[model samples]
Target chain A: MGKYRPGRRALTGATIVAAASLGLAACSSSGSDDSPSDGASAAGGSDVELRLAWWGSDSRHSATQEVIDAFEEANSGITVVGEFSDWGGYWDKLATATAGGNAPDVIQMDQLYLASYAEREVLSNLADYSALDMSHLGDSVLGMGQVDGAQYAMPISTTSFTLLVNQDVLDELGLTLPDTDAWTWDELGEFASSVTEASSGDVVGIGPMNNEYSLQLWARQHGEALFTDGNVSISEDGLASYFQLALDWAQSGAGAPADQYSEQAALTLDQSDFATGKQAMSFTQSTQIAAYTTASNGANLVPVKIPTEDANATPYAYLKPGMYWSLSSQSKHPEEAAQLIDFLVNDPAATSIIGTERGLPANPDTVEQLSGNLSPEETKAVEYTETLDPILGDAPEIVPNGASDTDPLIQRYLLEVMFEQSSPADAAASFISELQSSIDAA
Target chain B: MSLKELNALAANRSARRRSGGKADTRDNRAALGFLSPWMLGIVGITLGPLLYSLYLSFTNYNLLQSPSWVGLDNYERMFGDERLHQALKVTFTYVIVSVPLQLAVALGLALALDRGMRGLAFYRSAFYLPSLLGGSVAIAVLWRLVFGASGLFNVILGLIGIESSQSWISNPDTALWTIILLHVWTFGSPMVIFLAGLRQIPRAYYEAAATDGANVWWRFRHITMPLLTPIVFFNVVLAIINSFSNFTQAYVVSGGTGGPADSTLFYTLYLYQEGFGNFRMGYAAAMAWLLVLIIGAVTAINFWLSKRWVHYDD
Candidate 1:
């Protein structure tokens, strides 16, 4: 065969050279921005530029912007630069920034990324930010932000993957709401089926998102979790049960069919069958309700506690401190940066504007101050959560370093089982074995 | 002659020679200077990463950790990795099935349109448009809508009383074919190439064959077939490369899982899952190298076989 034309080859060659230069530049810039100086002391609260980055939905974006503006106005010496993106792109951007060592001064970290970040030494230990006082934050919320023995970031608020109910749907279908606080899997299935049948297919009872929330809930219920130090904690039986529910729903048409799911998956939640009023209930986090509510425009939504199998098998939800405000280990103005973070999380005015946009406030004082100001739905969610507070389980170890990579693998096996190509037992066994090995190697 | 007169004559001759050669030499050097930038890039950029990746393929280097020398272990591991096998099987099946079917349809459409149709350019552009956007996320998303249970496809099927399984995307058996059909639908590029090749075929050859009482089928078999062989060969090679590298559509449609029992688990998607998603960069690098070798070997075979069928008019 003839060789590639010289002109085309040369163009390709030049393009590669340019790309390499850009990559090298990106990698090198981080080192210069982060890391401590050899002899210079931390900068005073002068005209310091502090970069703050976070990921959130539109509501969080607006509220956070307002908080940032108030913080900047109150602290004239500090310049807070904000960067934000949706959840999907946030991690990839953070990882690359961490690798470069030029991470943001005040970063928003989730439990999913906290351990990995701490392990990689990308975040400054917030315990070192001596200027900021966090004595007022709740232990349950503050506890998650700690890595190893040292605190790396301050938890802003505590959130969980709670279930949102359409109370109107239940009322219309003439079915009483299941005891979500400690309902078993069998009870949930029956309730959903009855609702669907009674409505003549006008409503599909529940839309279970085959995501981390479901897996986490299922894992905890079975007396295990997704990860234990270096290996999987959930038993094969637990995984089989998880896949079985998803499959049974699809098979019985209690949820969207598999083919329909594949197609509907192409669209976002806003364009999904549920959003279009074809489905009644959906499993989601309390934070996600803001978007659903705005889209549904108050369609009789209610936040329910995650259903559990029994008292012994009580569902243990996570208080994801709505991510954390972390300092880059390489900042020149570490003190001022810490001050900026202190204002964002602890200051009353900033908290008021931010409201529960982050989540139910982790600060007891802030929660108390905003009690009467909350929307009816927000008040209900907060009350529901407080009632279930005593049942809250201990937080697991920070998500393992390779934790982010396992979702697709889990989804693959789950999909296989859903389509009946692989039996639940076999898929569960294969998934656990393969994923453990993969995580261990990583 | 005087000594001064002799020196002046020698200096004049040397100055004249220098002036004459300088312009020509400078022109030659200028041409080389323009070309050197490109030549340097080939060695430093293109070949540099190429060789570095090859070296990395033999090591255990995750993006976070330092690379450890592992000899051929990384490559050897591919033989045992179940996901790798599945991805390769899916990728090869896609290439083998989709490429030929797409090319045939493209050629057929090109031939049909060559019959002096009105607004031919409009039709050609309309047909060519899908190829430009076939691999994009939007199309992948649209593909989901068209084939979803509540999708347009199901609605159409329902009208005719043909009930379909709701798990189109979730069904392993049909997921791969759905992707294949999408690949086939983007026949615009190859069709345009075929049309171009058909135009280059001499009209006189067809007339001469007609004079020999050759029917349309015979004329096409003898005249059109041999002449279009070069384009056919080009299309096949290109299709194989493209199908092997297919990522965006599958990634978007499947949410990067390549799911439904791994039926749509393309090689690149699997590699991404292993590397970025799983943080198994070392394994991913090894997988990438294996894919290169496979694609290289397949292309080599295609070249070897082309001598038998590919013909050039020149």
Candidate 2:
């Protein structure tokens, strides 16, 4: 019995060991199998496959995939794999990829992060590739990509920050849209209050001002910039007035109440108070007029210039780069990557497929070609851009490395003031100090 | 005849021992073979990253560029970081408030369910459903719908003529409490543990106590409570750890910014913001290690204190 016991135990142990080893082997072997395919594709060998990644909606993704198919058809050897996600997930995934030294060959970049990536040298200089066409892009638009005199990204499109007004809400309240072109900040506040009072508070006159872009425009109107040469340059007084304006609007019942405003602020684009016709007006990017109009269920959403303190003297608008296409510094086939970007910019077929999903194309030829096919909302945005071209202020300086931190800091302070946890002056002071420290740390 | 049989038995034992050594060696090899996968996982997946993060905590790794050694700078920065203090305070408040409330609810339900009842399995599953779905993003989204300005809660209030327009989750004063309520709603796991612990308390003890004229509360206090201490300790430790590391509900409800003035900024969420949002991975790694140490210390204290209050039948 003792002799048999030892043998049985040994056999049982062997079986368990063999089973576990096989399980682990199965896991590791499968993992390793995936790496070689990625490695081979990234090596720019005979196949010359490239991975391109971007963040956008479903329509944008389908449009971009169509463009990729076209690129692949034109250059048979070069197959471009598309990776896309919504806005929030994109940055995290990109950061992880870049950290692991496995970033996609081509990437969609944002202005807020343009300088950050450029300073980190994660982006390859587009100027280094003469094969890519830059002659089609004008200096002002092209300059958006220049950091320290090296072009690390190329502008895909341009958009301006604007006020989107819901005409239906105004009509319901028996109020006409205010004159956006000549209205001062004070007059705008009164106009919002008048609408709210006229509507008996069923509809708010405006949503809360939570956007940092609005603050930037306000600062620019006061002859200051949010950031200058990599440090926060907006003064405390400028920031305080901006906060005070929002506070006054809220207190006067022009904007949604603080708690309701925060709830609205937390919602997605389609769920916004303005989009749902709960508010008559909200700050929005010009490129988003189409989306807002759609979300509003055919409500007459119109794009108007942001109201300024003095529109004639202080031109607070600029043609901001909607987004940029960049090549990763770790890309193996940068020349091919540049060629694809050039195609995306210059090819009318590709532009037709992309079709202002990214906003108006940066290339003038593509814009002119697509002029006859513009949606009514797109036409309004284009005309608005044309009117502002002569009067727009200088583009704000490229955002600094730590500018991402500023958005949350601004939101926190905005909430603090709205909740009466702190006075506007105190919140503004705290915001400036925190923003400065963030920038300094970067 | 007896002596010769005993001698033969001894000889057989000695022979078996000599051969058993060889079998033991084989068994050891087999056992090692089975353990190899788990050992490999520990070394490759867990230990590898843990050690790397420990090293990263001492360096200036920004996820974009190669790390540079900056010994103790990241840790030192935590001492002066106001946001860190805010996150810590928020997490502790959440833990302190949610743990006891959850355990009490769990224990109450557990005791009631311990009474013999009809459809016991169905009730158990129904009660356990919230815990199954507690940390999910869907529940968080549903929470927003239930607590928004025009949400179900306000609608109910309106029907009763209360006429309030406050967005409960967005109000700074009430936002953290909304999350805590969500935490307390998921008491199923601890309730199940408590139910099992109650069953283990000898029914005969209660019977004897009844003879002594003890009421339901009195019997529960002396007999059931004493026996359930170990389970309560287990639940408390787990509840504290879970609350400290909670991220999904807070992240989803606050729209990933921990907003309305950072009121719901759980420590894990703040660490995530620093690591992923701000790209300050080194600082985040330090925060991660600090969280680990805090949880570890708390758990150790819990165990040490368990000796006094936790009763064991054996």
Candidate 3:
């Protein structure tokens, strides 16, 4: 018995040591899979492979992959790999990758984050890449990507903040569409209230308008910028008016109750009040009109100019980049990256594959070429954008660092005012102070 | 009781001890070999990151830039940050309210299920299902749908003529409560533990109390309560620790913003937002360490207080 005990112990010890080593080996094997290719790509060679990353829906993924395939075919020596994720997880993954010094060669950029990444030197300066073409892109649109006179990103497409109206709901209520071209904010509010009164609450006239983008447009209509000179520049009075209009609309029975309004504010695009056929009008960017239309099951969704305080004054509507494509500063093959970006923007065959998924193409020639194949909704977006071309104001300055962090504060303050938890004046003051402090901290 | 028996026991113990010396070394080697996987994981994955985070807490380490030492700046910044305070308040309120309510439900259900009855296994498994799914993202999404403005809860309230028009999950005043209820609904694990504790109590004790003329309430108070204290204490400690770190439900329900006026911002969720959303990893590390300290202090207090009420069979 004693001899067997010692033998069993020896066997167990040997088995356990073998198992431990195997476990560690399993972990190391999984980690090393990506390092070889990653190391090879970082060592820049004539035969270069690039990692391109973006965030979008399944359709966008397939189309972008097609574009990548075309780019790889055109430049036989360069291979491009696609890394994509949904918008929700994209930023977190990008931040981790960038921190690890393994960022993709090309990244999809957003205006809200352009300054932050550019200032950190995580993005490469596009002006250094002579292979990239920019003459076809408008200066105003391209300027959105510039920080301190260096172009760090190039705009791929543009979207304008517009009012989306569910015309089916309006028609069901026997109400004619209000003339948005000359409508004032008060006029819009009254028309909305009338629709709600006519429908007897089966439908709300409008959903809440408390988002930062809508507030920015509201401030812009009053000749105020959301941010200027690296600080929040919207006046307290301007903010108060902005909140007060939504409050008045809520009180007048044009908008959802404060509780439902807040709920709708937090909903996804497909679940919004207008998309669910519970509201006649909602504010959205032109790029969102298609999603709203699809959600409403082919309802007659129309986009119109946002109402202004004075229609004769400088137009408040501005063309904003849907997103930008920028090269990473860590890329080993910046020239190859530049060639890919140029191909995406200038090659008609590639743009055709991209279609209107990113938004209307930023290039006028690409827009014209893609116009012939647009879906009805896409065509409507194109026509809507062109109509505003004659009167659109200059785009606001690039959003400052830490600006995205202010979104929750804005939502909180908006709800506080709407629910009468705080006065509009007080909410405005608090928002301004908090926003400035956040920006200052950044 | 007898000196002879006592001496025999001592001799047996010494004989075993002498032999154990040699076997002990061999046993330890085998045991450590078996434990190597977990030890390696702890050292490489857990402890490595934990110590790195402690070092990072003293620096200004935004993800994109190299960390620069800032001494206590990250900790100092917490004093003036209202959002940090709000997150703390929300987390404490949630933990304070949730842990007790969840244990009560767990203990109550456990007592009821402890009786030897037909289909007991079926009922046990059925009740345990929710706890299995409680921390999942799908459950969090279901929670949002259940408490949405035009959701099942409000729909039922309307049917009952309660006249509630508010979205329970989005309203600042009640959003946290919905999440607390989600925590309470997942009381199955503690219930199962309490069941085991209840079964450990001798059935003869209850019969003796009955013969001594104790009523149902009296029997429960005298026989059950004292005997179940250890399990209750175990459940309370675990529930408090789990509640303090609640994140997935709040993150999914709040859409990762801890929104509707930040009413549902758990501490860990706020830490994630700072680390990932704002890219302030140093500040997030500081917050993470603060949470560890807070949990440790609370647990120490619990252990100290347990002596007054907790009872052991021996």
State the lDDT of candidate 1 residue by residue for A51-134, as single tens digits.
Answer: 788987667778888888898898776667788986656766666565455667788887766766676566788877777878
Estimate candidate 2's RMSD in Å: 6.5
Per-residue lDDT tens digits for candidate 2, residues B193-213, read 888877777677889999999
lDDT of 2 by residue, A272-382 (tens): 788888888888788787777777888988777777766677677777888999999989888899999988888888998876778878888989998999888888878
Candidate 2 TM-score versus the reference: 0.90
Winner by DockQ: 2
lDDT of candidate 3 over B136-242, digit per residue (tens): 99999999989997789988999998987678998889999999999999999989988987887778888988999999999999989987787677677777777
Error of 1 at A119 (Å): 1.3
Better of 1 and 3 by lDDT: 3
* Model 1 clashing residue pairs (backbone): A34-A330, A35-A330, A258-B167, A259-B166, A259-B167, A259-B168, A260-B149, A405-B277
Candidate number achieving the greatest TM-score relative to the actual structure: 2
List clashing residue pairs in candidate 2: A17-B34
